[model samples]
Target: MYICAFMLILGLAFYFGWSAAYSAWTDMGVYAVSIMLICFGAFGTWTYYNIDKENKANAK
Candidate 1:
């Protein structure tokens, strides 16, 4: 569950950032994408950590 969430978050970040970076639109838009990457990246990392911990505890 957490892994899925993590993947989703990362996917969103990449999608947004890539699109913005490649786009010839305003610079502010690209900066917004960068912010999204940072925010989503953090959520993904923390969620994965919790998921791993839960799985390991269950295995023992």
Candidate 2:
């Protein structure tokens, strides 16, 4: 449950940032937002994957 919330937040943040980047013509803002989105997305994904692995390990 916690993992899902985190994933959602991170995903939304990334999506909005990317959208803002696309709607604007400035390269700097786009690049910055893109970098942020990538980092957040990667971290969220990693956290979710680790949680799944942990749960499986415990089940076994």
Candidate 3:
């Protein structure tokens, strides 16, 4: 749940970053933030799934 919230925030950050970058058409900072958000979100989602799987296994 916490990871999901983090991912949601990152997704919003990416949206805002991309919007800012698009408006300016050349802001490297926004691109960098977007990239970081993508990477972090992906890693976090993967970790969440792995942990969920482990919990299910333990329950079984």
Candidate 4:
């Protein structure tokens, strides 16, 4: 469940970042938001993967 949520956030973040880069860069607020989203998504995805790995290792 947490993994799914992070994945969704990551996906959306990429989409927004991409859009902002191509067209919305002129808007500082939108650009900043996109950048923040991308950073959050990356961190969340990385953290979740590590947690999942730990869980699997302990289960084995």
Candidate 5:
């Protein structure tokens, strides 16, 4: 979960960096890939936290 959050932050930083460095927002392919990374990172983090919570509840 922490790793996923880190990845999400990293992805966001990378996207901003790429935009600043290359001005590639006009490119759809680049946008798609970058957005995908951010989305996946967010989703993974959310899923992990929810599963962990569920497991803890079941344990009791």
Candidate 6:
């Protein structure tokens, strides 16, 4: 649940940031936000996989 919420928020932020950067014609903000977006996505995916593994172990 938390992970879903986090991903949703992060996705929204990225959308807004991307639009802003596009309109402003600036690379700096877009680059920074994109990096963060990728990092957050990767971290979230890792956490989800770890959680699933733990749950499966406990189930056994």
Error of 3 at 13 (Å): 3.9
TM-score of 3: 0.58
What digit string (tens of lDDT, one per residue) describes model 1 on residues 1-60? 556566556656666666767874445655566556656666777777898999999999
Query: Which candidate number maximizes TM-score?
Result: 5
Clashing pairs in 3: none
* Model 3 per-residue lDDT tens digits across residues 1-60: 567558658866776767776785456776667667666777777888899999999998
Where is model 4 more than 4 Å wrong at Cα?
Answer: 1-26
Ranking by TM-score: 5, 3, 4, 2, 6, 1
Give the clashing pairs for model 4.
none
Give me candidate 4's TM-score against the actual structure: 0.55
- What overall lDDT, based on C-alpha atoms, would model 4 receive against the true structure? 0.68
User: What residue runs in model 3 are displaced by over 4 Å at the alpha carbon?
Assistant: 1-4, 11-14, 17-22
Write the residue-wise lDDT of candidate 6 on 1-60 in tens digits: 466547657865776767776775456666577667666776777778799999999999
User: Candidate 5 regions off by >4 Å?
Assistant: none
Error of 6 at 3 (Å): 7.5
lDDT per residue for candidate 2 within 1-60, as digits (tens), equals 456555556655765666676775456665576566566666777787899999999999
Per-candidate Cα lDDT values, in order, are 0.67, 0.66, 0.73, 0.68, 0.84, 0.69
Q: lDDT score of model 5?
A: 0.84
Model 6 misplacement above 4 A: 1-26
Candidate 1 — which residues are off by over 4 angstroms? 1-30
The digit string of per-residue lDDT tens for model 4 on 1-60 reads 466566557666766766666875466665566566666667776777899999999999
Top candidate on lDDT is: 5
Better of 1 and 5 by lDDT: 5
